[model samples]
Target: MTAEQRPPVRGYAKPVVVPERLDSLTGPTTGIVVLPRHLKWSGNSRYDLDQPGRIADLYRTVLNEAATSDDLSRYLDRATLLDLWSSMWLPVALRGKWEDRFPELRHRRYDPAA
Candidate 1:
């Protein structure tokens, strides 16, 4: 799917508090739009949720980093990590037509055992 076609990332549950006096003219605004912590894209200056590829890339990074880190095991067990790896493509899969563009994403099949 094209980046434009992707949906905006969900916002944080708590709105960011903008300081009342950034400048004399600017007033305090509640919930100023900001990127969701979970959805932040690596190497992206701006937040664009429409790109499923970004999510895929982020998952790839997470998997790679987790594999090399000893601390990851303390937070997540093997089963949980495996499940996360298996389902990493869910976002791109749900969008449809992404396989042609991103071959890295494997097609998830229904496995009775799973």
Candidate 2:
């Protein structure tokens, strides 16, 4: 197949930032919360939320205040993150089998001591 005839590969684009939506001053002084844009996926393409780009975006938007591992754990559960990783990054054929083998991926019990 010619280069042009081959299917085009999808790539990650920078997340759309809404300055107005972001809190100008974030910290103890300001109690404002900044919510991230919802993760959107292109139909059935290799592109999905599990990519580093998307993960970075998620951290930027949802977990911006997660300074420490403990803080991060409180903000978002590890299982949720793993689920996204499995669902979005894993090949379709492997998802069910992989999830079955690794049931722990379904939900991670939070342990602050750890």
lDDT (CA) for every model shown?
0.34, 0.35
Steric collisions counted per model: 1, 0
Report the poorest 10 consecutive residues by lDDT, candidate 2. 16-25
Tens digits of lDDT, candidate 1, 10-98:
53232222112212212111222233234334554242324544433443333333322332222223333233444564334232323
At residue 78, what lDDT does model 1 achieve? 37
Alpha-carbon TM-score of each model against the true structure:
0.22, 0.23
Q: C-alpha displacement of 65 in model 1, angstroms?
A: 2.5
How does candidate 1 score on lDDT?
0.34
Which parts of model 2 have CA positions greater than 4 angstroms off? 1-60, 63-65, 86-114
Against the true structure, whose lDDT is highest? 2
Candidate 2 structure quality by residue, lDDT tens digits, 27-93: 2211222332232232221223444554434433343223333434433434444534433443222
Once fitted onto the true fold, the runs of candidate 1 whose alpha carbons sit more than 4 angstroms away are: 1-61, 90-114
Instruction: Give the local distance difference test score of model 2.
Output: 0.35
User: Which residue pairs collide in model 1, if any?
Assistant: 6-50
